[model samples]
Target: MQSVSEEIKIRPIFNTQGVCVINSVLYTGYECTLFGTNSQNEIVEQLELESEIVKIFPVYDKVLISTITGKVYVYNPAERNNKLQCVFTNSVIKSIDLDGEAIVLGTADGSVILSDVQGYGETFNKKMDGMITLVKFISLSSIKRRYNSKNKLVAVGDAMGTVTLFNTTGEVVYREKNCHSGQIMFIGELGNKILSCGMDALLIEHSLESEMTIRNISENIDETIGACSLVGDRLFMCSKDLVITLSADLKIVAKKRLNIPDINGFDVFGECCVITTDEHDIVLASVVQDTLVVDKVLIGDNDEITDLLVMENMVVVGTNSRYIRTICKSDIERQNENGLIRNKAFSGELVKSNNEECVLSMCGSNKVFYTGSKDGIISKFEVVTGNIRDSVRAVKSVSAEAPITAMCLYQDLLITGTEYGIINGWKIGDTLELVFTASASSSEITGIVVNNKKIHCTSKTKEIIVVNLNGGMDSSISGHKKGMWSISEHCQMLLTGSSDKTARLWKGDINSTLQHNTSVVKTLLTERAITATSDGVLRVWNTTTYKELGAIRITEIKDERIWAIKRYAGTEYIVSAGPSIVIIKDSSWEVEKMKEQMQKEEYIAKQHAIIFMKKGEYVSAAVEYYKLNLERDLKDALKRITGEMDISPLMSVVLLDSYKFVKRVSKWARSPYLFTITQRILQTAIENRIEISAKEADDLSKTLLRTAELFNAAY
Candidate 1:
């Protein structure tokens, strides 16, 4: 299986500064719960985030956060021993900003929410025209002729192309009439001009006085721009492909586009652009010969950088692993700067890749790429000339015994779905170790996609889970059951078309069997289907209306039930593969057996364990003895047992695990089998000089002596 970091893909850090931070909900990379390289360029206090930090805004002292599951958290970097103080509210925060407890949040319903984050104060909610994408205070404005100081002016951008400016003291000042063509990525105020950037490469310069959209920049750019910032007329805007700078009137000053395969987000600090990549590597860049030159790299231990922050000269990074990174901007910026690239761009390092699983999914640019594999490995490969680069480890292999089924890339983050019920994310970097691993559902994640709100995923249990991703890497599970599979936008809608012959759809996120409780919204039978096979074909069906979209004749069967159905380009040609046949479909689908056969074996093992537990107290003790160290020694031990007995490896694990949970065991005076085994273990321990409790060892020795005497008597 592929376990090398090079095999997996990672996104890039689009921005950075004097102070930067990364927030994650599910994992921490460098063995620290919360590790931050302080301004002193050393890892300081390690702390855990309250839930999962999806977005973090570094304020004066503390940081404001929006969680994946739609919660908000305010963390204070008081001292090394400061406790993580947080609060929860009912409203789901889509985006956030920290203004001295004046928490400004972009809500899900296209509202800009202002909360007094300092003390126990009420959160103020107000609606906007469209779903809010970003909310920011007009910190500093143009060479101010005269602008309100105390009465803060806030800029709110939304899903649509509109960006409105609201004053904290009172009414609207000026709204950009034609802000952007589509969704506005971000908006900010630079001097007197209003800066707005969006999905398309459009960044408009408008006058605060006239409210008129002036110079529309993106003139020569050829990629999607996600964010924009400015330092007195020198405009900084990020593109889907690179970071570009413009003059006051929208003239292209300089462009920094590192041919990164994937990018998450980016920040700018004092002549440096801290770009976080998909592999969790923070590339610190500086201006060198008219280009944004990369001078240093702070590699995150295989963490998917969900949100990047640069606050008050302090750096913070959050991961999907439920941890916040307070790293020093200098820690990453401390590297040798290379002049213009001459012959070889730094040494072309070649190393042998040690990944076990083969490739399963891949994404990235023409120069670099990242791949996710069966062995849980996330690796990165460089495109040297026209050949693929060697495998360099990025994210460590995961716990998924089955192959990684799906990979979705956004910015610098890679979201992976496996056959097991796990959706893990990893940032791309030099080392391949898991920085954050989250469980979307234990339903065997098969597919993952990112929309405006959350990262939508589908699992083997045929459930769609939508988790708000902006809340940092550790964002919570909000948008619960609405995904592409649900077929409908309603969270109540559900469907069952795969193996369970009679396709059933539900109205809630619950399993189909529990639909009776939530009301079965709709149901359709795959009536003409044959017995379930691994490679069987499947056709599309409607759950809400209970209608099969295509004809049943085309959804045919070969040797086995189809495990997966894939469509290419348009819906015309498709591919459905399973145990044997990879049936290319014209307009068809299939049903197949559940892939988790090991779960059944594990259940059987647990049953056997319970039986053994009831045998006697001594026998029960065996459970804990073996299971306590199961992950360490027991895994290989169980592997040996399965190899010897031809038993299911899953069963062996469950049986051994029973030993770990064995609280008590009993030895009846009439049970000879127990006495024999106990005596043999005691004798072995004594011979190997391993310690055994005095009283227990004595009892075992006495039992053995008595048995020996009995044998002598019988002879």
Candidate 2:
């Protein structure tokens, strides 16, 4: 019997920060802690900063931390707090990079300033237009010295879409105006070439040869390129719409469209690239045959991932909303190689509460599930099966004086809002630990969400209260004139439904998306704003217009009163909590699932074929392998049955994975029949002028010489 591991591959990293791997140590800054970890990303050294850290840069043996208040702190294990130095600036520093012995700072004041680490004084400074977004250090060691012996180069990108390259001696080497139509987000260098990508949706390459020449390497790709990195000779760029890899010659090697958007950052190591999405999705993609194919995807329990560092065997992720987490790269690869069975939507099997009271609120990640009931009890359940009843294991229970109204997961913390207007936060691991409890509202606590290191909670008092996690001066945000029921957030917009018979959309920035007045009784947000009313009609509103697009009423249900609305991305289903947990049937979501099912079937068939091949059923396995477009497996099956079957039928199997087939045949150089198979395949490849690597050519030469020697010895 074959055993399959049912463990979820990727785990959650609570609040994270920008991560980088230095000499096998994962360095990252999250919230107030700047830490270093081992290869498995286990924290070995931790230091708490005075203020919240924004960015982390590794300069030589020390780690430099840039704070939100424009203060820079240099941390060294050998130096104590008093012995370590700090640099203070007036304006906010958005980005930092190391150039030679000087630390380059990109400030919000639109200036690129260099602070010498040795002297702890400003060595050079130059003012630019708009806020400086990114600072990158590029070494010109490979370039000829005739360009003035300046081996150190610094590239600064600003919000106005300009990229300027400066020499170590404060001399301008290259400048490009409007290199990107929008803010430049990324700047990476490979040899003498520089790659820049930004909101303009353009990827431009600049040559640092004799004269600086700029070229648009990518077309006006419609999606904003959020992050980019250079790996070997390939440049990996990711955006909301797609992930693309381009060669050094400006030709695209691979391109993959994404179903989910907003890739916060990515790091490339060897053949695979680790991707972190804004919604806390970590994905692994492999480069094969000029195509970037998604090998594995792990949905985090909670916490928005901010950045990641890819290592040879592991990945260290930093999050803005939680602490740092380390995941094994081998686990991701193993799950990808072996078919991974994804979690399906909850089949409406009720897990009755201990007191038989109605479960009011439910929120969970893939790892665990939490439910709150009218009994004033909060229960933690481990996910076990597909159905709700079987999937839940009542592990721990906590009680509140009042009935629980709302619940949310933030990293390891589980926050609960109760009717008594109290907010409780619990940190869960081997056991549940109550972190803090606060009297947040005078009336019933309605909705809650953690954002910007603050807890935003709405209540029957008709106001939203914002409290910092670290405990400080709390503030109340005024907008809703009546009691609020539910709150949902997407991107920068927060949607709330109030008892005043109105649904309000709060924009994080000046540019708001909600245009029309929505009078829906309740507004729940996801990628779209979904609303419900007393009229028993649930409507979907366009997020841009905030206008009704469609309406649906559940079949056989008369009341249609919805207590809560939730979006589940794993199954692409929108569920409503009311008389019954109703799954609103969506055609688009169903279509994607249908496609996935079809592909899953094909994958399962391929796995069965491999199993059959191991059992020595060649003919039947070959047919199944052919259906999966696994040409190499089909060829191997043919090789085993060479004398038993005609070569014509074996050759008829159309080769789809030619690269894998050639590479496989290259290994069977010692076998007489397999050697002939290898020679014939290479001959056909040469005749068809198929692309083959230099390693494959060398393997073919050795196989042919060995075959010739074997033939001479036989004569």
Candidate 3:
């Protein structure tokens, strides 16, 4: 599988419905798209469907996807075919599960459908009360072999909080009504008991023999249960801000408070869990000492950004909220230095406005900055350099009859545009003094630029009004077929972005209209003219030639809109803001090349290790696999090392701590020869008097005794 290139790094800008992890690949569904990511959080595959994705089922080597349009398709990533095979179509599929080739689908209309993947196979359909929310095929053959009865069972949960267990012939084996107050979210089988967690924040355990509730758990959970998964003998239930781990007997093992307030989806893989938040951040967490610690956070912004201003060493971000964030360039660089796997949070300083309304526009020059709010209030702020850090303080406030929409600094004047098509120029000193006022347009003014002592502004009426600084000599220029959103000026060139999905550059009468795939929302000018579109792409165009240079996709969510783009003044870095801020450096191409080289080298080394294994050079192959952190391959190679003479080299390769070594080999206790060899290694380590903690030694000793019992029982 081809991984995502290093030239592009995705910081999530929106939440997904759910996440699934299988074979080390994470699958997530958002709107009409399904994305698959590898262990490194890089996009490996993206499948765009016709409708919104509803549910995903991992069936051995293939994946079955259900959409809101009631279509079911099967995809096999291991195969060469990229097209999904449509198997069935019915009412909106809410959940699905598979046992071998038998497929079970639960629909939103409270119907259960059982069929095979070929579509023409013998099918059975049954209807129940309320919408069917969850479905699973559980086997109880091993625990009930003495009954001499059918073991394949189908468990279904409905929106009315009813759970029903059925046999293959459509016979209802057991039924429980009103198991929860709200919709059922999850259903799982634990030995002879059935586990069900519901949106009512309740986890219920039901006995198969008695057909009654064995236990009901609602402690330490205040929010609705969103999802649940089974790992080993433990059950993991997740709410919006909490996760509870329970033993097989329904006893709470650990309760962890995940600080994320808006969790959209989460999935547990091995000892770690991945959480996707509505704030567009992907949080990676793991249990350490019974506490869930956030190991890394893929940072994203919280709200829609309104404007961005580039200053000396900081980038000021104005959001739709009544607050502006100041991000230091040095802080961003420092976070980037923590390696790709570490946390990437932009810990910026937040400055709140006195106004209760949202910010609409912003402009700054040197240490002084101004912000215009939706309530016709404009606040002036100055940067206060303190002993430790820089802060912003409000200096003065001014108001107009209408909301301020755009602002720009020209010479010694601060020119502002209002929603009522009014323009005013003010001189900045200890206080603001209005010098000139003009009626600019017929509609709300969206953008403003001052060039050659002339004030030019564009409005929602698709007209650009140009006037002198004295508010005289006003002339209207036909701007675009649609409303213009942004405007920029560099020397004699004028650039304007419009809702007509085009950016136009005008130098005198000669103008060039650059067509884009989506509506242009913002335009910026550096050495090149850059236009940001609603499709999350920033396209760069040569100003003089009006030729397209390249395009960068700033976000994965299509049509998310790029609100603002600015050149980090006097640098090759470009800062773009939307739901999050992204800074792209000029050396990205070289960095991409270096990363490609590293991946190639790793692949080559893996190939060499495989060759060594095939050639019976187990010691060399083990070393190479250890270096690559391929634990499975390293263990397999170590198992091949036989005879007492090879013990020295084997000990050198298995350089793990005493506890970890026992834990590793305990998983393979069924293999008699390997277990014997591992026993010899442990004895040698004890003879060497390797230092170990008392807790670790006790745990190691218990694990070894269990492994020995299993080995003897198997033999």
Q: How does each model score on lDDT?
A: 0.45, 0.61, 0.72
Q: How does model 2 score by TM-score?
A: 0.41
Candidate 1 lDDT over residue span 1-715, tens digit each: 1110011111121122112443311112222124454322234444554554444455554555555566555555655465665576655565666566576767767777666766565455577777787788776544233464554667788888887776664356667654677787767765556677887766676566554654555565656665555544576666644767777666787876665423445555556566554434455666554456765455444233222223222222323322223333223234323321111101111121234434555445434545555565555544333233222323333343555666666666666777665666656555533445666666555556665546766554544566655423334332223222221122334333333333344444443331112211112122211111233323444333444344322223343222322221232222222211121222322221222354565566556554544553323323432544333233223222311232222233333323222211123111343344433333443454544456655664565667667656666
| Per-residue lDDT of candidate 2, residues 1-715 (tens digit) | 1111122212222134355545655555546666554433234556777787776666677776677777776677555353346856465667777656778888878988877766468768899988998888877565326456555678889899998888777788788877678888788686566777777667667666544445554463555677777767777777764877777786777777765436777765455565666654545566776566776544422332222323333333323222223334343333222364221211111133353354566666654666676777777655454331223346777776578877777787888888888888888787767788888888887778877667888888777787666433388877766787767677757777766667777776332333224334455677667766655456666567665555665322454355544442332233332322333533433444676798999889888888878988776677677667676786687566544443433333434566665655566556565665556655655666666778877877887788769867876
The candidate 2 region of ten consecutive residues with least summed lDDT is 341-350
Instruction: Please report the TM-score between candidate 3 and the true structure.
Output: 0.53
Best candidate (score: TM-score) = 3
All predictions: root-mean-square deviation over Cα?
A: 21.4, 27.1, 23.3
- How far is 290's C-alpha from truth in model 1 (Å)? 5.7
Off by over 4 Å in 2: 1-17, 23-25, 35-45, 77-84, 99-102, 115-121, 139-146, 207-222, 257-261, 267-275, 280-715
Instruction: Name the Cα RMSD for model 3.
Output: 23.3
Candidate 3's residue-wise lDDT over 49-166, tens digit each?
A: 8888776666666677777788878777777357898877876777777777787888888889888755667467899999998898877674345335565778899999998887
Q: Best to worst by TM-score, what's the order? A: 3, 2, 1
**Which 10 consecutive residues of model 3 have the lowest summed lDDT?**
1-10
Q: Give the TM-scores of the predictions, in the order they appear.
A: 0.40, 0.41, 0.53
Q: Global lDDT for candidate 3?
A: 0.72
